[model samples]
Target: MGCALSGPGVTPEPTFSKEKRGLDLSEETECAETPEPLHLSEPQKALIRESWKILHKDIARVGVIVFVRLFETHPECKDVFFQFRDIDDLQQLKMSKELQAHSLRVMSFIEKSVARLDQVEKLEHLAFELGRSHFRYKAPPKYYEYIGAQFIQAVQPILKEHWTPEVEKAWESLFKYLTATMRRGFYTEEKTAGSGGKSPCSRKAGAGSTPNKI
Candidate 1:
């Protein structure tokens, strides 16, 4: 459930002005206003749950394969991880216990997320908190998209027979939902940190608003 990979060190930038803040959050605000932003249906939920049951058995392998593929396809990503940064050989890196452990942790988070499919609010909260934590860890949301795609690739063969267009769509929808909320949380933290520990947007929204909850 923790940060799946290390992020580059971040030095906070200057806070936005009133007009600038509006500009900064305009897209995020638009996304937030959209109803059923995830587009996940009950049938999609069922497909995700069923596929997960099969995928979970090879969780460890899937986890390792995911990151390895990530490093292969996006070699720059490896530089973010302090532990793996120096390791040039993908084959050698594969055997490292550190990679295995962290990869497993990421998968475990996926496990919990699958279990929370029926509780939409809880699921969103979980992803949001993780995103906030990533902000602290200096993990940019840009890399989040890569992980979901890598995960899908890693699990396809494991569920070779069970893998279907429907299942793929379901998982893709889930990742989309998670990444969207996570992006919101990341921006929320960034705004708060940049503005001397208070988010200007949330202040305008008042107490107990969606921004505050995120």
Candidate 2:
């Protein structure tokens, strides 16, 4: 299974009660009229692929750091996971079996996507499907930006001698594609669901098979 970021504050407010949801773009969410497809050059792919090789090897330890930083950035996200929900201790949440499993799951998704960077369509499809799944979580485009940021912050130290601007840009490109495609899938599903306001968690599928919180 891959990662879902456990959308900490992602309950769509209008439809649900006060306790639900989140977005990445922060302010406005009017989907772009002509959302550009995020693309990567051969060199860019090479940079990302090689760089990821260094990071994935230590994903168990590094993945925890990523989630820790992620929750610290959005403490509200702690409530999204049943494991961490209502817990007062930050370290406890960080070390819980749930966080460990979930964070690693999320990393696996990252790993799968990174491995396919060379296959642009394949990569896009991965994002497309990921977006479709995330639509259920009510996660907004901006969260992609957040996830990408934490991923780098967590992996930079592990990469030590290798992290660079170019590598960061490559990861950014991948996140852009993921954000755009996910929004596309989410909105499309939302439109099709109409005012019926179906909860994404109602159906079980893919990596995030548990609840649709994140």
Candidate 3:
């Protein structure tokens, strides 16, 4: 729904060469508050959505490569995803339908989130639901930042000259909101469970997962 699941598009690769190994995406700042929803100006949302449209052209390549690069950057977290764990070969895993299917699901979430940016209530609800689902699967907060970073890297090439300061800021802001909301969901459930309440994700499997649309 988000991106076509076809061969890698012919977009020129971004210049994320070895020189960017020490890429400090953290340098991009954000709102300091935690439990708050991510705030964005209309212009920022426009820039982010427009940028995504450009990258969406090759979301299959971008999504799969994000997983590859993420594992490259943080291999310790590989086992978290059942589809990725126990793979003797990285290249083979990247091409697997399992990975592609999972990637499409993630892309779908991004597509939905971007499309609803103008509707704060809808966007926040969507984000909270996603965070709530993933929290059940034991995804830590850092995964958001790392995965988002890989995504940014994947799309940087297609963004090219249009990836301006405002665009970068917009992405950083949106990503930060995603991470914060997810963390919020994780902790909220933890608090609920601690107080002997039935957390929505207590069902064990598919508790905090994206809906079965992929």
Candidate 4:
């Protein structure tokens, strides 16, 4: 997996309370418009897995495309990355080693998430922790949804005929589930840190914040 600069404070391993473990996929769907629980049937899972196999071959390019598109559509997000915040040139960013490494970290996280679909609890835990880490990184949950949408747009051309509505729905459901869990984690950390919420840890020269892995 790729690595990025972590936020200053130390984050503990996530714990699953009885109530938290019992939460169904839909329980975290923070969308007011659609409160439906997340439902990914066997066929949908299979569709995502199969499509991922084809996309994985171009994971690097896709990762770059996803983030580039994200920055293009949501320029404010660039502010969250210390290493990238000052760089106004989008084309130069595509070639940065930091961007490449960060992209790999994100793609690796997605790969792991896809592998864990059969294990719901594990998948939830993974995403939850990622959110907690993001809190330290100062990357809010609002930007999480954009990554998924950009990923879909980046891969649709590669998936071509295989990119059916069902496939799209499956990916969307998975992202929604992940982002919802992530949001829960973000709030949990926020509450734990209390008001002011600045990290107790010291900062490093190039330590930039990102949403990919802890």
Candidate 5:
């Protein structure tokens, strides 16, 4: 259940602007007008629960194996991996074995976290923090898409024999939920700052702006 590898922290300086504040307010208003309930179909919830049971039954071994396989396939993503100590660094590097190890560790942490997917609030926060981490690393948002795809690719093979159409649907549903939740967190933070209270964007904007290490 522990992370397999650890890397430096990558925290990005938040950005904000008075001019952009209006835009943020508009966005917040739109979001407020929208009704976004965590509405999952019964089948979707069942699938996620079943997958959790299967994965959690052997979380440590499965998580490590998934990480190892993913790194083996996408060796280039190593640079995005952050060490625990360097979590706040924003510098990017060429792909390397060290990066690969770090990537695996991040995956390990994610897998362990995913086992607790039933806790919607915690999972949402984890996704947001992860998004922030990715931003800190200067990784393109497409990397999140890549991670999702590669994760399914790496896991499906092992899961295929035992996997059902329901399981596939469940994973797809889960991914969508996680992605939306993360994006919502980002938007909400932006909206909050636009309304005048302190925000990461605002904090990074002023002279006293300081990044938070994850």
Candidate 6:
């Protein structure tokens, strides 16, 4: 899990409702019915399990690629990310030799996390929290769509040969699960706010008045 950063004083208005945001799967009709429990053949199960390992490694690799591309293609977005300077510091942290060691640690964590198929529930919870963190950063909801597209684009070339229909299906399923979880978290925050609850770092009006980095 990423460390939580203290937010800036500027509280950007929510760009969109949870329902309108990217990856929303709140509509009951939108969720693919939990498919009949797959009774996978031994070989098929092995293939899927192996494929998941590959996916884990590939996602991390692609994350680096996407991060680089984002910095290059939309420096403005980078600026927004760094408005509070924590994002900038984290980027610097990732560039250090220590990052290679940290990557290994994170990879180990990923392996353990994925060891059980039943752990998907926990994974969903993590994703939801990550989404809330993104909101705390004042990232526009559309940024998720942009990042997702960029991730797919980055991986397509490398995955072309191994990207079977099943692989696509698996990723789609994983993303849908994540999206639904995020939507739930977003709405929960909104409800809490409406009820006069405060976030840990609620911003004062006119805080974060710094001009956007763009």
Q: Which candidate leads in TM-score?
A: 1
Runs of candidate 1 with Cα error greater than 4 angstroms are 1-36, 203-214
lDDT by residue for model 3 over 84-118, one digit each (tens)?
A: 67775888889889888888888888888898776
Off by over 4 Å in 3: 1-34, 198-214
Provide the global lDDT of candidate 1 against the true structure: 0.69
Give the range where candidate 3 is weakest over 10 consecutive residues by summed lDDT.
1-10
| Candidate with maximal lDDT | 4
RMSD of 2: 8.7
RMSD of each: 8.5, 8.7, 12.4, 12.9, 12.3, 13.6
Candidate 6 lDDT over 2-91, as tens digits, reads 111111221222334443223332221111112112122344434446665556656556666665565556544554433222344545
The TM-scores of all predictions, comma-separated, are 0.78, 0.73, 0.72, 0.74, 0.50, 0.50
Indicate the TM-score of model 1: 0.78
Among residues 3 or more apart in sequence or in different chains, the pairs in candidate 3 whose N, CA or C atoms overlap within 3 Å are: 133-208, 134-208
For all candidates, the clash counts are 0, 15, 2, 2, 14, 0
lDDT per residue, candidate 4, 61-146, as tens digits? 99999999989998877777778777889999998888888999999999999998877666766787787788677676667778
Per-residue error at 29 for model 1, in Å?
A: 13
Alpha carbon lDDT of each predicted model: 0.69, 0.62, 0.61, 0.69, 0.45, 0.43
What is the C-alpha lDDT profile of model 1 across 1-214, one tens digit per residue? 1332212222222343323212221223211322124456788888899999898889999999999998898776676677877898999989989899989988998999899877666777777778778767655666777898888878888999999988887887778667766765777776678779876545221122222111
Model 2: how far residue 129 lies from native, Å = 2.0
* Model 2, span 1-214: residue lDDT tens: 1223323222222332233334222323322223335457778888888987887788878878888887787775565565566666778877689888988888898898877655555655567567766656655444555777788777787888898888877787667556665655555455446547563433222222122111
Off by over 4 Å in 6: 1-48, 55-60, 71-76, 83-116, 198-214
Candidate 3 vs candidate 6: the TM-score winner is 3
- In candidate 4, how many Å is residue 189 off? 0.6
Candidate 5 at 42: error in angstroms? 3.5
User: What is the lDDT ranking, best to worst?
Assistant: 4, 1, 2, 3, 5, 6
